[model samples]
Target chain A: MILNDLSELAARIPDGAKIAIPPSRSGVAIAATHALIARNARGLHIVAIPTSGMQADMLIGAGAVQVMESAGVTLDEQGQAGRFVAAVKAGAIRLMDSTCPALISGLQAAEKGVPFLPMRGLIGSDLLKNRPDYKVVDNPMADGPDPIVLLPAIQPDIALFHAPLADRRGNVWIGKARELMTMAHAAHTTLVTVEEITEGDLMADPLRAPATIPAMYITAIARARGGAMPLALEGVYEADSAALAAYANAARTAEGFAAWLADAPGIAAA
Target chain B: MEYLPEELLICTITRLLEGTGHIAVGVSSPIPGSAALLTRALSNGKTGVTVLNSANLQTLNDGAGELFDRAAQGRIGAFFLSGGQIDGQANINLVGVGQYPQQDVRWSGSFGSAMLYYLVPRVILFREEHTRRTMVDQVDFISAPGTSPPEVYRPGGPYALVTGLGLFHFDKLRARFRLTSIHPGHSLEEILDNTGFGFDYEGEIPITPTPEPDRLSLLRGPIAAEIADPYPKFAAAIFKS
Candidate 1:
C-alpha cells in the first residue's frame, strides 16, 4: 500500500510496537521518526539492527522508548549519544546490551525461521550473564569439550527505514544497505520512506534488480524528499555534521532537548 | 620533526600494524583508520584496510554481518577495540561504570568488541585517555575478555594496547600487560602516576619512535584526502595546516 504521507506511516506503528530501525550510517527514516514523535507514540521497543545513533537518541529523549536492544548507540565523531546516556543513567529504559554479531545472528535466525543460532565468543563476558535468554551449551560436533553461545530469534513487529528510491509498485531500492533487507525479512511488516517514486519497475533493470527490495515484503511506502536529513543517504547526499553537532549540544539537558525537539524543522513544519 | 599527539599515535599504531595482511577498523576510530590507511600506502597497497562506514575504504559488500563472518573465517588479520574501562588483564568494559543495566554512568553499549576481540588475530586496544579512571585494576564489566580458557574455540586475542601516553604489549599466556615504551615527551613516572593497574617493564624503558619526515608527508597528503570522505570533521581539524 502507498501511504499519503509520513503521518500515515507513523500511524501504522502503534504504541508498544517492536520496531527495528537501521543504524545512522545506513538510510535512517528521520522524517518518519519525527512523525512518530509528533503523534506522541509511546512505549516503543526499539531494536537497533546492530547499533543506532541520533534517531534512537531522539526517540529515547522524547520518552517514546521503553526498551532498547542493541550493540551500542553513538553519534560517531560527535561523541556519545547524550540522550541515550542520560536515559541509561536515570534507568529510564530497559537496556538489552548485546554484541553486534549477536544481534545480527538473532535477526538472521528469525529470517531463517529458526528457534536459535549458535555462535562463537561471549564465553566469559558479562553480557552473557546479563542476558538470561542466551544459552551456553557444549558443541556436539566437537571431539572435546567445546562451548558456544546460542542467541534466540528476534522478530520485530515492524522494520522501518528510508531509501533513495521506490517505484510506484512499492519496490524500494536499498543499494548496498543489505542489513535493511535482513531487518525487513526478520520483521512482521516493513515500512519505508523514499525520496521519489519512479514509473518503471525497479526489478526490470538487471543492474538495479540486485539491490531492490521487492514490494511483497514492504507493507507501505511514503514519499519523503530528503527524508534522511542530517544523516546521509550514501550517493544522494552527505550528512549535515553542523546540524548533528547542534543536536548533540542541545540534547545535553532535558529542557534543551525539549526546546530543540519543539523547534525541530520537521516537527514544527508539521 | 614536531607532530601532533594524534599523528604520533597514528605512527605508533601504523608500526603495530606492520605486516598484518588486512586491518579492519571499527566505528568511531579515526586514528586507527588513518594508521591502517597509512600502513596500506607504506606497504605499496600490499596491506588491505577496511574502515567500517566508509563507502570507498570498506571492501565488504555483502552486508553488516559480512565483517563478522569474514573474521570468523580468519580473513580479517587485525582489528581495533577501545573501552570505557580497561584492566591489567586486558578485559575491557564498554558497557558502563558501577554495575550492569542500572549503572551511575553508561556509554554506548558494547559494540562488536566481544566477537571481534576473539576472532581477529591481532586485536589492538586503543584509547586516547590514559588515566586511573580509565585504566582500572579490574573492569566493572567484561564486555570482551582478553583471554579465554584453553579448551575454548579461540584463535585470536589482544596483541597490544596503544594510548596517548605510551604503548604496551599484552602477554596472552601470562594474562598481563608489559610496558613496552613510553611516548616521547612523557615519562615512566607520568605513566605510573596516572595508571591504576600495574605492569611489567625493564630497568631502562625506551621512548616511542617519532614519525619520520616521509611518513608525516603521506599522512598530510594522499591519506588525508582518502580519509576525509568518511571523517571530514576529523580530517579538517587534524589536517587543517
Candidate 2:
C-alpha cells in the first residue's frame, strides 16, 4: 500500500499484540514505531530481540515495550548498558538466555506452522527449567534416541524490521545481516521500516537486493529519516540518548517505571 | 625450540597481551587466564594491559563486572576464546550441532563470540584439539568472518591458535595457516596430519616457549583472572545419562 505518513500506518498495530522489532542502534523502524506511538495503545508487550545495550533501553524508556533481551550492551557514549538487567531482576520484564540461531529456530518453527523446533544447545540450562513460558517437551520422535531435541514455537504476532533500503512493495534488503533476516523470515507477520525507498523494482539491484522480502509477507512500509541509529540517515538514528537516560534513572529509583513512562513519548491509552 | 608448550603458549600469549592495551578474558578460559597471569607474573605486571572496570568483566576479577565498562571505548585491547568448530578462515561456533536443526542448547553462550571475534583484532584461538573435527573441512556455520580477504583487518582475525599440540598463525601475506612452532613432543607431520586442510609450509615446526615456575604461579595466582563460561546446566545435561 502507498503509506503517505506515519499516522495512517500506526493504526494497524492494534494493542495486546506480541510485537517484535529489530536490534539495530541505527533506527530505521522509528517511523513505524512513531506510528505505533500514535496508536496510543496499552498492554502492548514488546519483545526486544537482536538489539544489544542502549537501543533496548530506548524502547523501554519510550514505554513502547516491556523489554525481553538476552544480553545488555553499553553504548559508545555510556557508562554501562541500561538497567534491562535490573528490570529483569525486579521481574518487570522476562529475560531469555538466547543464541541467535536458537531464537531463529524457535521463531521459524512458530512461523512455519510447526508446534516447536528441537534445539540441543539449551537442553539442561537453568533458563529452560526456570522459565515457565518455554516448554521442555519430550520428543516423541526421540522414540529411542539418546540425545533428543525439543521444540520452540509461538512466534510474535508482528516482526518489525529496520532496513537500509526497501521498496514500495515492501521488499527488504540488509547485507551481511547478523541474524536479522532470520528473525524477520521466522516471524508470523513482518513489517519493515527503512532509511530509503527506491523507485525501481528491488529486483533490479543485484548486489544490494540479492533476495527480496516478498510483499506477501510484508504488512506495511514507511519512509522515516534518522532511521539508522548514530546518524540521521534515510535510515534510523542511533539509540536515543534521552530515552536511555530515562530508563537508567527508572532502573535505579524506588518508584515503578510507569511513573517514568508518564513523562516520555510513547503510545498513550486513550 | 625455545619455549615448551606451556612456555610457547605463555609467551605467544604474552606477545598478544602486549598488543592489548587493556586486556579482558571471560571465565573458564585457561589461555586468557594464563595470558593475564603471564603478563603480571612473568612480565612483572609492567605490560600495558588496561584493567577495565565493567562489572561483568570483574566477575572474573573479584565479583565485579564494572571492569567491562572500562573497556567500552576501545579502551580494552584484546581477549581470548576457544572453539570446537573453526573454518579455514577463523570463525567460531561453540553453540551447537550444525548437522541437526532441532536440538535445545543450554545458555547458548553469553553472545558476542561472533560479535567479539569478528570485531576484536587480536583474538587468540586456543582449542585442545588440533584434529579433524575441531579443525573442520568447513565449519557448519559462519559464526563470524575472518580477515575479510586482501583487505587488512584493523580490529580483526585471530593472531594464533594454541592447541594441545601446536601454535598456528594465519600468515597475512598468504592468508593461510603457517606453523610457527609446536609443543615439545610434536612434529610437522603430526601437526599436518591433525589439520583438516593443508597450507603452504616449511620444513620444521619450532618448539613452543613456556614460562618458569615463578611465572606459572603468577598466572595461576595473582596476574591471571579465571575464565569461565559458567553453564552449570551443560554439566547437568552431559551427566544426565
Candidate 3:
C-alpha cells in the first residue's frame, strides 16, 4: 500500500502493537514519530535494536510507549536522554533492559524463523537474571561442562524507519545501514518514510540493486523530505545541533517537553 | 608537565593496552577511544582500532551485529565499559540506582557492555567518579557480573577497574578487586574514605606512572585529530597540542 501522507501511515499502526525501530545513527522515521505523537497513539511496545537516541525519548515523552526494550537510550553527544531517564525513574513504564548483542541475536532468530538462538557472551550477566525468557543450558557440543544463554526470537508487529530513497514499487535503497533490512525481516509489517522517490526501478541499477530491499517486504511508503529532522540522514543532511540542543534542554521535565512539543515543527502542524 | 584529568585517564588506559592486538570502543567513550587510537599509533599501526560512530576508524559495514560477530570470534582484544554504580565484586549497574521497575535514579541502560565484557579478553571498567555512591559496597543492580561460575563457557571478563582516583586489578579466581596504584595527588586514605567497599593490597601502594613526553606529545597532536571526529568536545576540552 502507498500512503499519501504521514498521518495515514501512522494511523495504520494499531495501539499496543509491538514495533521495532532502528538505531539513532541509522535512519529513524522522525516525521512518522511526529505524526504518531499527533495522533496520540498509545501503548506502543518499542523495541530498539541495541540502543536509541531522541526518538525513544520523544515517544516516552509523549506517553506513547508502554514497554521499551533497548540496550540504552542516550542523546549521544548531547548527553542523557532526559525523558527516558524521567520515565524510568518515575516507574511510568516497564523496561526490558537488554544488552546489545542479545537484541541483535533475538532479531536474528526471528529473521531465521527460529524459536530461540543461543549466543556467546551474556552467560554470566545480570541481563540473564532479569530476562526469564532467556535460558542458560548445558552446551551439548562441548567436551567439558559448559553453559550458554538462549535468547527468544523477537518478532515485532511492525518495523518503522526513514530512508533516503524509494520507488513506486516500494523497493527501498538503504545503503550500508543493513540493520533496517534485519528489522524488516524480523517484523510482520514495514512502514517507511523517504526523502524522495526514485524514478523507473531502483532494482534496475546494479550498484543500487544489492542494497535495495525489494517491494515484497515493504507494507507502505510515504514521502517525507527531511523526514529524520534534528537527526542526520547521512549524505542527505547533518544533524541539526542547535535544534537538538534546544530539545535536550527542554525535555528534562514533562512540563518542559510538552511546551517544546507544542511548538515543534511537524508536530505542531499535525 | 601539567596534565588534565582526562589526559591522565587516557594515558592510564593506554598503558593497560600495552600489547593489545585490537581494541573496539563503543559510542560516547571519548577517553577510551582516544587511548585506543594512541595505542594504535604507538604500535606503528600494528594494533587495530574500531571506534563506533566515528567517520574514519569504524570499519564494520554490518553495523553492531558485525562487531558482535567479530568479538565472539576472538577478533577484538580490548574494550571499555562504565556504569552508574560498580561494586566490590566488580559487578556493574548500568540500569539504575534503586530497586528495579521503580528506580530512584536512572542512567542510560546497559548497551553491548555485558556482551563485549564477556568476549573481549581485556575489559577495562572506567568511571570518572570514584565516590562512595558510585563505588558502592553492593550495586543496586548488576547489569554485567564481573565473574562467571566455573561451569560457564566464558573466555573473557573484567581485567581492571580504573577511576580518577586510582587503578584496581580484578582477580577473577578470587572474584574480588585488588588495589594496584593510586594516581598522583590522590591519597590511599582518600580512596578508602570515598570507597564504600573493601579491597586487598600488599605492602605500600605505588603511584601511577606518568606518561612519557613523547607519548604525551603524540596524544595532544595526531591522536587528538583522530579522535576529534567522534569526540569533538573531548578533544577540544583536553588536548592542548
Candidate 4:
C-alpha cells in the first residue's frame, strides 16, 4: 500500500517485531528509524545484515531496540559507537554477537526457505561458546574429518531500507546493492522509503529491470526525500559529518542524547 | 636510514606482503590499508588489494557481500585484524573487557574477523600499542580464535603479528607466537617488560630492517597519495615527512 507519510508507515511496525536493517554505505532507512523513534516504537529485535553503524545506535539510544543480532556495530572512521557500547555495558539489551558471514549465511538460508545452513568458520571462536543457539555438527556430506558450524535461518518480521528510486508499483531500483533484495526475500514483510517515486514501471525498462525489486515483496511504500539524512545514500549525498560527530558526542550520555533528540529535526519534528 | 615510526611500521608490513595474491584491509585499518596499497604498487599491480569503503582502493561492486563471498571462497590470500586484547595463542578479542554478559569496556563488535580469520590464508594481527594492557595473558572474550582443533577444516590461520615494538611469527604447530625481530629503538628487555604473554626466542634477535631507499621514497611519495582518500588523517600525518 502507498503510505502518505513515513510516520504512518513506521506506525505499522508493531512492538516487539524482528526487523532487519540494511548495513550503512548501502541503503539504510534512516528516515524510517527516526519515525519509529518518534512514534515510540519499542522492543524491536534489530538484525543487521552483517553490521551497522549510525542507524543501530540511534534505535538503541531511543530505547527502540531490545535485542540486537549483528556481526558488529561501528561508525567506521568515527570510532566506537558510544550509545551502543553504553547499552551493552548497562545490560539494557540482549546482544547476540555474530560473525559477518554467519549473519549473511543465515539470511541466505531464510531466502532459500531452509531450516539451517552449514558454514566453514566459527569453529574455535568464543562466539560458539557464548551463543548456545549455534551448533557444531559433523559434515555428513564430507567424507573428510572436519566439523562445520550450522547457523539457524534468520527470518525477520520486517525488512526495512531506503533506496534512491521506486516506481508507482512499489518496485525499488537497488542497483548493485542486492543485499536489500535478499533481506526483503527473507523477511515476512518488506517496508521501503524512497527518495523519489519515478513515473514509469521500474521493471519495464531493460536497463533497470535487473536491479529492481518487484512490488510483490514490498508491503508498503512511502516517499521520504532526504530520508537517509545524516547517512549518505550511495551516489546522492555524503554522510553528514557535522551531524554524525554531533550524534556521537551527544549519545555519550542518556541526558545528552535526549537533549540532542529534543532538537533533532527529523525525529522531533516528525 | 632514519624513518618515522609510522613509515617504519608501514614498510615493515609491506615487507610481509611479498607473495600475497589478494589482500583485504577492513574498515578503520589505515596502516594495513596503506601497506596493502604500497605492496600492490611495488609488485607492479600484480597483487590484488581491496580496501573496504575506500574511494581509491576498493574493487568490489557488490559491496560487503562480494568481499565476504570472495573471502569464503579462499580467493583472498591475506587480511588484517586487530583486537582490544590479544592473547598468547594469537586469539584476537574485539568484544569488551570484563565478564561475558556485562562488559566493563565494550568495543565495536566483531564485524567479520571471526569468519575471515578462519578463511584467509595469512591473517596478520596488528595492534599499534605494545603493552601488557593491550597484549593480555588471556582475553576476556575470543572474537576470533588463532588455532582450530584438528577435526575442524581450516586452511587459513595466523601467519605473523605486527606490533609497535616488534614482529612475532605465529607457529600453528606450536600454537604460540615467537619473537621474530625487534624494531629499531626497542629492546628484548622492553618487550619482555611490556608483553603479558611468553614467546619463544633463540639467540640474539636482529633489529627489524627499515625499508630500502627506493621503497621508502615510493612509500612516502605516490603510495602516500593512494592511501590519502581512505585515511586522510593517517596519510597527512605520516606522509608529510
lDDT of 3 at A71: 93
Instruction: Sort all candidates by lDDT, best to worst.
Output: 1, 3, 4, 2
In model 4, pairs of residues that clash are: none
Predicted candidate 1 versus true structure: per-residue lDDT over B1-241, tens digit per residue? 7899999999999999998899998887899999999999999777998998887987877778999999999999999999889999999999889877888888888889889888899999999999999999999999999999998888988999999899999999999999999999999999999888989899999899999789999999999998886787789999973
lDDT (Cα atoms) of all candidates against the true structure: 0.91, 0.52, 0.88, 0.87
Name the docking class for model 4. medium
**CA shift of B198, model 3, Å:** 1.1
Tell me the tens digit of each residue's lDDT in model 4 across A11-109: 889999999988887888888888999999899999999899989998999999999999899887777787899999899999999988889889999
Tell me each candidate's TM-score.
0.97, 0.49, 0.97, 0.97
lDDT of 1 by residue, A92-198 (tens): 99989999999999999999999999988999999998899999999998899999999999999999999999999989999888999899889999999988889
**Cα lDDT tens digits for candidate 2, A199-245:** 77776677655546656667777665544433223222334556555
Q: Residues B1-241, candidate 4: write the lDDT tens digits.
A: 6788887888889888888899999988888987898889888768999888776677887645777789889899989999999999998999889997679998888889888888899899999999999998898899988898888878888999999999999999998999999999999999999999988998999999987788888888888888887778788888862
DockQ of 1: 0.83
Better of 2 and 4 by TM-score: 4
Across residues B1-241, which tens digit of lDDT does each residue of candidate 3 receive? 7777788889999999988999999888998998999999989778999998877787888865999899999999999989789998888988887778678888788888778777889999999899998999998888888887878657888898999999999999888899999999999999999999888888999999887778888899999999998877778888742
- Identify the leading candidate in terms of lDDT: 1
Model 1 alpha-carbon drift over 4 Å, by segment: A267-270
Worst 10 residues of 2 chain B by lDDT: B100-109
User: How high is the DockQ of candidate 3?
Assistant: 0.76
Give the CA lDDT, 0 to 100, for residue A96 in model 4: 92
